[model samples]
Target chain A: MTGAPLLAVNNIEVIYDHVILVLKGVSLQVPEEGIVALLGANGAGKTTTLKAVSNLLGAERGDVTKGTIEYRGERVEKLSPNELVTRGVVQVMEGRHCFGHLTVEENLMTGAYTRTDGRGAIRDDLDLVYRYFPRLQQRRTSQAGYVSGGEQQMTAIGRALMSKPKMILLDEPSMGLAPQLVEEIFEIVKRLNEEEKVSFLLAEQNTNIALKYARYGYILENGRVVMDGNAAELAANEDVKEFYLGLSGTKRKSYRDVKHYRRRKRWLS
Target chain B: MADLFFFLEVLIGGLLSGVLYSLVALGFVLIYKASGVFNFAQGAMVLLAGLTFVRLTQILGSEHPWDGMFVLALAITFAVMIALAFAVERVVLRPLVNQAQIIMFMATIGLTFFLEGAAQGVWGSQVHRLNLGVSELPIIIGDVLLPPLDLVAAAAAAAMVAGLAVFFSRTRIGRALRAVADDHQAALSVGIPLQSIWVVVWSVAGIVALFAGLVWGAKLGVQFSLTLVALKALPVLILGGFTSIPGAIIGGLIIGASEKLAEVFIGPLVGGAIENWFPYMLALVFLLFRPQGLFGEKIIKRV
Candidate 1:
C-alpha cells in the first residue's frame, strides 16, 4: 500500500462446472516485491484465488465468472497460464506436484520451456537454484517422486525459480511439512523475495508463521475474504487470534461453562 | 544344415516384422504417455496415412519412384499429417481438456471410427499397391536368405526410433512432454502449454503412422485391412507396457518372433493359422503375471 500495487484482484468470483460457486467477489493486492499471505481454512478458496491469478482455473474446470485480475497495471486474467509465465508470473501449486517420473534436475529444466534465453542462462539459473536449496542439488539426479516431501517442495519452488519469474503464486507451502521445515521454507521465500525482487502471494492455513513472514495478510472464510490488515494488526486482533491462531486473551474456561462454544464456532463458519 | 538355415530365415524375418509392429506401437505410446489417452485412432491413423500417401503418390507420379514425385509426395503427405494434428487438437482435445481419462479414451474410440470413415470417404475404399522400390525377393546370404524388403523396413524403423529417442532426451520440449506425462497440473503451472504439447505429440504420432503406412502398405497392400495390421500392435503394446519406448520395441520383437515361431512350428500340432491369435494369447497370459507389463510404471499404492 505504499506504492501502486504489482497485482490487483478486483472483486473476482469463481464457479466450477458452471453451477457450484466458489470465490464470491474477492479482491486483494500485492505491492512490488511484497510478501502477501492469503490465510484461510481448507475450503476458503485460497487455492482458487491463486489459480485464478495464474489462469489455471480452466484446467480444474473452474472459471472466474466475474471481476478482473490485473498485474503490473495490465488486465492479465484473460491470458493463458503459459503466457502469464512468459510475462514472468508462475505458480507453485499446492501438494508440490513434481514430475514423479523425471529426475529433479529434469523437472527444473522443464520450467525453462517457454524461455528463449540460451542454455548458458538456464544453466546459471539451475546453479542459482542449487545455491538456494543445496539439498536439491544433492537429490537432483534422483526421481522426484522418490524424494522426501520437503525436497519435493524445494524442487517445486526451485523449478519455479528456473523460470526466472517476477512473481510466484504459492498455494499451501506448509500443507504437510513439519513446522521446522515450514520455517525453513518461509526463510527461503523471504530470501527469494528480497534477493530476486520477486513478489509473492502465498496462500496458507498456517496464519502465525505466514503473518510473521508476510507484510500483509487476508483471512478468507467460506470463499470470501472476511478480514484483511497489516500483518501485525491482524495477528493482534482478538478474533483472528481466537479463531485462526488458537489463541485468546482469557484463560481456558471450564468444560461445563464453554460446552456451547461450539455455537460460536458454527456461527463464525 | 538346411533346417538350421530355414530356422534362421524365419527368425530374421520375424525380428524384422517385429520392428514394423513396434513402429505402430510407438505411435500409441507417444500419445498415451503425453495425454494418458490410449488413442484407439492410432490404427486408423496408420490407415489414413497410408491412404493419403498412396493417393498423393498416384496424383504426383509413381513411375520414376526415385527422382520424381515419390519424395515430393512423402513431403506433402507429412504436411497433411501435421495439419490433421492441428485440427484434432482444436476440435477434439481442447474442448475436452479437463474431462476424465475415460472420456478422452471414448473420444479416441470415436476418432477411430471417424478417421476410418473420413479417410475412406476422401481417398476411396479401393485397395492400392504401394511399391517402396525395394526388392520383395530374398537376398541370399551364404546359406541363409533374407527378404530385402524386410531389411529395408527394419532399417527405416530403427532410424525413426533413434531419432525419437534423441528428441525425447536432448530437447527442452521433450522434457516438457515428460513433465506433462508425470503431472498435468504441475506442468501447466510451470508454463508448459498442454495444448501445444498435445499437438506436438499427435503430430509425432502422425509421423510414426506414416512410416508404418509405407512399410505395411508395401507388404499387405494399402487396403482398409492395414488397420488390422495396426490392431495387431495392441498385443505389442500390452506386452511392452503402454508408457515405455523400449517396451514397445521389445514387446514388438517378442510378439513377432513368438507368433512366427508358433505358426511355423506349433501350427501343425495346433491346427493352422494360430499366428492370428497367438500374440493375443501370449498377452492374456502376460497380464496374469504382471498387469503393468515389462516396462510400464507400476502404480504406487500407499498403505
Candidate 2:
C-alpha cells in the first residue's frame, strides 16, 4: 500500500435493472505497477466490480449506485468506457470478445485506435506483443473466429497491449481454456507485468493460479469481500484453502460431503 | 442474328439499371454496418438530395448565367447532405443508442416519412429534371445500341464502389468502421467512440444517397416516385443479405438483370408487368436455398 494506488474502489454498490443489487459494498485497490487478483466464484460480483471501474456497467442496464471509483485520483463514475480507455485504463471483457470477422492483425490494430502515435511506434508495439505471444504472429492473417480458443485469448490480450495501457482489467482469461493453456497464458501475463510494468486487476475463478501470480488478492463471496491478504497469506489461510483451493487436511469423500460438514459457516460468523 | 443482338441490348440495359439499384443499396449497407439499423429512409434521402440539387441548380442558374453555377450547386448540395447527416445522427440516432435493432429499424421507417414530407414541403411536389450534362442520345455500335446515361450511371457506381473499397481497407476511419461493423462492444472497448462512428457512417450513407438521387433523378426526374426506389432496394438487400456491401452490388445486378430478362421472356405468359414482383420472387427463392445470402458470413451459434 505504498505510494498512491493506480485504481481504488471504495465501498461501491452496483444495482442491475434498478432493483437487483449485484454488488453490495465491494472494495479493492491495485497499486501502481502491481498485479491484483479479484478471486470469486460465479455470481459473486467480481465482473461487476471490474465493470464498475471500467464504466461498462451502463451497457448492461447496471449502475454503481453508491461509492466512488478513483482512477489516477479522478472520480470515474461519470466517465464513459471509451473515455476510461483513452486515459490509459482498458478492460478485456470476458468470453474473449474478438472481432470475429476481422483478421488477427486487424483485431490487434483496433486496440491502437485512440493512439495518436506514428505508424513506426504502433508497429513496434505490435512486434512487442508478437514477441510475447509468438503464436499470434504465425496466425496474424487468419480471421480471429477461425483461430483456436487459446489463440483468441492471446489475441484479446495482445489487442489490449497494443493500446499501450497503463493498467488492464482482465476478466476470466482462463475461463474455457485447458489447464496447460491456462498456465501458459498466466505465465505470459506474469512476464508482461514483470517486463512491461503494466498493472493488472484480474477477475479469476482459478484461485490457485491467480494467487500464484497476484501480489495481493481479495476473496469475494455473495458480493462482499470475505477476506483480503497478501497472496502467500491468502494461499495459506484455512478458509480459502478449504473453500476455494479445494484442498483439505484429510481426503474428503466429495465436495458435497464437505459442504454438509461445513453447514455452519465459519466465515459468516 | 437480329434476335441475338436484341438480347444483348436488353442484357446490357439491365446491367446498367442494376448499377443504380446498387447505389441505393450501398446507402443501406453503410448505415446497417455502422448502426445495425436497416435504414428505410435511404430512398427518401435520395429523393431529398435530388430535390436539393434540382432546386439549387434552378436558383443558382437563374441568378448567375455562368457555367460555374452548376458546380456551386453541387457543392451546396453536398453541404446540405452533410447537414442532414449531422441532423440524423443528433436527433434520431443519438437518443436511440443500445436499443433493439428492430426499434432502430422502425425509427428509420419513421425517418422515411419525415424526410419525404420535408423534401416535398421544401421543394414543392412537382417533378423536376436533373441534368448532369450527360447526352441523352444513344450510341450505336454496329447492330447494338448503348444509352449514354446508363453508361454514365454504371461508371459512377463502379468508381464509387472502388473509392469505398479503398476507404474501408486503407483509411484509419474506414478500418475503425469495419471494426465497429464486426463488434460494437469490442470497438468501444478499444477507445473508438461509437457515436462518432455512427455520425461518420450516416454521413457516408447520405453521400451515397445523394449520388443515387442524382442518377435516378436524371433518368426518372425527381418526383414522389423516387421514394419508391427505397422499396425496390429492399428486395436487392434480401437477395444480397442485409450486412454485406459486395452482396448489395451483386444482389442489385441479379435483381436488375433477372427482372428485365423475365419481363422480356416470361412477360407474355404472365401477361406482362412481371417487373413489379420478379425481384421479390427471385429473392424469396434465393433465401429458401441460402438464408445468409451470397457473400454473407455464415452465422455460427454457440450455446
Candidate 3:
C-alpha cells in the first residue's frame, strides 16, 4: 500500500484447457517484507492466483490469458516456474508436496538447487531452517512419505527456505493439520517474516487464522476479489464475521434460523 | 562329485548372464525414472550402438591395423549415441511433454520401430562380428568353467552400477533427477528445468544402451535379431519394478539365473527350451504376491 509492491498481480485471467475460465481479472499485491493473505472457500480461484504468480499454470494446461504478474520490478508472467525460483520467488504447492521417496534432508537440499552458493552457505541455511522447524532436523534422515502431516508441512517450508527466497507463495498450509499444529506453523511463518524478512502471499481457507497472521487480507469469491482491508478491519467487518469466521454478532439461533438469515444478505443474493 | 561341479558351473554361468540382462534393464530404468516414459526403444538403441560400433570397426580395420583405428571407431560410436540422445529428446520427448503416461509409452514403442528400421537401413541387415578384444574362450576357474566374455560383461555391469549409484546419491544433477522422479511438478517448482533433465537422462540411457549393445553383440553378433535381446530386459523390469535401479540389477540376476537353472534342471522334465518362458513365468508368480515388484514403492490410493 506504500512504495512499489514486491509482487503485483494485475487483472490476470486464467483459462484451463482453452475452455474453462478459472480466474477472471484477479488482482492483488504484497509489498516488500509484508504478508498478504488470500482468503476464499473451495473453487474460489485462490490456488489459481498463486499458480499464476509462480508460472505453474502451464503444467496443468492452464494459461494466463489476460493481465500481467510483476515481481521485484520485473514482469514474470512468461517465466518458467524454475526461472522464478532463480529470482527468489518460490511456491509451496497446495497439498504439501514433499518428495515422498527422498529423505527429509534431501528434500530440503532440493530447495537449494537453484542457488549457486557454496556448501558452507547452504549448510548454514540448512541450520537456519532447522532452527525454525526443529522437527525437520529431527526427521532429516526419514523418508518424507513416512513423516506426519505437520512434519511434512514443515519440510515443505524448510525446503523453500533452502532456496533463500525473498518471498514464498504458500497455498493452504493449514489444509489437513490439527488446529494446534496450524497455529504453530503460522507462528513460525510470522517469526520468519519478522526476523528473516521473507514476504508471504498465503492462500488459506481458514480465514480466522489467516487474517490473524497476515498484515493485509483479500477475500475472493467465484474467481474475483469481493473484499479486502487491513487485517484488523477485515476481522471486525460484519459480513466476513458471519460468512467466513462463522461468527454471528447477534443472539444464537437454530440451523433453520441461520439459513433463513443468510438468504437475506445482499452479497449472497 | 562331477555332477556337483557341473551344477556349480551352470549356476555361476547363469549369474553372469543375469548381469548382462541387468545392463539392458538399467537403460529402461534410467529413462523411466527421469521422464516417466517406458522406453520401448531401448532394445533398438542397443542394436544401433552395437551395429554402428561393429561397422565402424570393420571399415577402419580394413584400412589399417593401427591401434588408433579402434579408438577412433569407439569415439565415433560414442558420438552416435550422444546424437541419438539429442534426437530422441528433441523429437520425441519435448513435444510430448505433460502427455498421458500411456501415450508417452506408446510413443516410445513407435520410437522402437523407427530406430530399428534406421539401424537396419543404415548398417545393413547382415550379421557383423563384434570383438571388443575380450577372449571368447572359456576360462577354467578351479573346478568350474566360465566364459571370459561373460566375466568381462559382469565386471563392466558392476562398475556401471557403482558409477550410477554414486551419481544419483552424491551429485547435484543426480539429486535433481531423483527429485524429478518423485514429482515432476514439485521438481519444476524448486527451479529444476524439466526439459534439460530429460535430455541429460536420455543421454545417460543412450550410453547405457550402447554399453549393453557392445557386450551382447560381442556374445552373439550385430544382427537384427540382436534387438530382440531387449525383450529379455522386460521380465527383468517387471521383477525389478520400473523405477528402481537396484531393482533392475537384482531382477536381472533373478531372471537370468532362474531361466538358465530351469533350462538345465527342469528342461529335461519338459521337452527343453524352458528358457523361452521361464523368466516370464517367474515374474508372473512373483507379481502374484508383490504387485509393485521387489523394490517399487507400494501405491497407496488416497481419497
Candidate 4:
C-alpha cells in the first residue's frame, strides 16, 4: 500500500432541499489498498456519506453543503457521477441497481463505457469477472432482473469492477443477503482487497463482519463520526461493543452473531 | 363473383393508398423514436409542405414546370423544414423537456394549431393541383392497369423506408438516436446533444411529411383537408409499436390493405365510410391483446 492516501474526505455537511441538514461535519480518510468501514444505525447518514463520495447524492435529493472530497489530490466535490466514474471513483450503489432489462454482460459493459480501451481488454476483464463468480458466467446471457439476490449482489460488484475503479464505495453490501451468502460476499470483498489491492469504503450495518475485514473503522451517530480509530481498537471498545457489536458479558459472539438491541435498554440507564 | 376484377382493382388502389398512410406513419415514428413525442403537428406539417411546394413552384414560374421545379422547390422546403425544426426544438421542446410527458404531448398539439394557423396565413386558403410530373399514362399488364401515380407513391414510400433503415443502422448519428430512444438519461450522460437530436428528429419528420404531401398532392391535389390523413397514422402507430421502423412499414401496409379490403367488401354492406374507421378499429384490437404493440418492448416501472 502507498504511504499517500488515495481518498481524503474533509468535513462535509449535506443539506436537503436547502433546509433540512442530513449530515453535519463528517470526515473520513481512506488509503490505497485499505478497507474503511462506516458503521451507523439506520438513518445515521451512512448512505448519504457514500453518496457524497460517489457524487450520487443529487439523484437522491441531497447536496453537499460544505467541504470537498479529494481523489489523487484533486478536488472532486462538484463533479458529476459520470465525471467521477471516469476519474476512477465508482459506487456499487445501496440497492442492487442493476439495469434490470439488460443482460448480465450488457450491465457489465455499461461499467467500461467510459473506457476507450480495445474490445480485447474488455473481454479479458469480463473473463476475469467470471472467474471471480462462476455462477455469473453461467447466467451471463440472462437478464439481470431475474438473477437471485446473492447473484444480483455479485453482479453489481462485478459490474463496478469492470470499470477497473481504483476505489469502490460499497453501500450496504450485506443489506439483504442470507447469513451464508453474507459470509460469502464478505469473503469475496476480503479476497478483492487482498488480491486486487483495491481500496474500499464500505458502509455496513453488519458491524461484526465489517470490523473483521476493515483495517480502520468510523462509527457514525446522527451524521457525526463519534468514534474513529484502528479496527481492533474500535471493535474492542466497550461502548462500541454494546451499541454496535451486539456483544454482552465477557463471552463475545463470533462473526454472524446476532443479538437484538431495544431502544428502551438505553432508557433503563 | 362477376365483380372479381373490380374487387382486385380496388384492392390494388387501396394498397397504393396504404403506402401513403405508411409514409405519414413513418414521420410519426421518427419523432417518437428520437424525442418520445407523438407529434400531432405532423398533420399540419403535411398540409404546410403541400402548400409550400405549390407556392415555391409558382414563384419558380410556370415555364420551368413542376418536373424540375418540384425538386428545386423541395430543396427550398428542406431548408425551411430545418429552420422550423430548430425553432420547435428551441422554443417548445427545450423548455418543456423536464415537464411531464402529458404536458409535452399537449404542447405539441398546441404546436399543431399554431402551424395550421401559420400555414393558412402564409399559403392562403386555396386548393392547387400538384402534378409530381410522373406520367399520367397507366401501365396495362393484361386486364390490370396500374396508374403511374400510384406506382410512384408506392415506390417513393419503399425508397424512404429503405433509406431510413440504412441510415439508422449504418450511421453514427442514427445509432445515437436509437440510444436516445433506449434511455434519455443514459444518452445525455454520454455527451449527446439532446436538444440537437430533437431538432434533427423533427427535421426528418418534416421531410417525411413533405414527401407524403408531394405524392398525395399529385394524386388528390393540394387542399387543407389533406391534413386528415395524419390522423390515419394513429392506427399505424398502435399496430407497429411507437419506435420500430419495420413495425411502421408493416403497420402501414396492414392498415392500407385492410382499409382497402374493408372499403371494397365491407363498405357496401355498412353504408361506406368504412375506410375512415377500419385502421383505427384494427389498432384498437391490437391494443387489446398487446398494449406495447408488435415491435415495442414491454415497459416495467420501478417505484
Give each candidate's interface RMSD in Å: 1.4, 1.6, 1.6, 5.1
The top-ranked prediction according to lDDT is: 1
lDDT of 2 by residue, B1-303 (tens): 999998888888888888789889999988887778889899999999989988988987634323688778878889888898888889998888778989998999999999999999988999987777788889988788999998988987898999999998777788889889888887877778888888888889988998999889989998989989988898888888878889999989888888899999899898999999999998888889988788676664434
Q: Please name the candidate that would achieve the greatest DockQ relative to the true structure.
A: 1
Native interface contacts kept by each candidate, as a fraction: 0.87, 0.60, 0.67, 0.01
Candidate 3 per-residue lDDT, tens place, B148-259, comes to 9999889988999999999999888999999999999899888888988987888888899889998899888888887789899988988999899999999998898889
Error of model 2, residue B113, in angstroms: 1.2
Report chain A TM-scores, every model.
0.95, 0.97, 0.97, 0.91
**What is the per-residue lDDT of model 1 for residues A3-100, given as tens digits with 9 covering 90 to 100?**
88999999999999899999999999999999999998889999999999999998988998899999999999889999999999999999999898
Better structure of 1 and 4 per lDDT: 1
Model 1, position B14, has a per-residue lDDT of: 87
Q: Candidate 3, what DockQ? A: 0.67
For model 4, the docking class works out as incorrect
**RMSD value for candidate 3:** 1.7
> Candidate 4, TM-score vs. the true structure?
0.75
True lDDT of residue B247, candidate 4: 84
Rank list by lDDT = 1, 3, 2, 4
TM-score of chain B of 4: 0.94
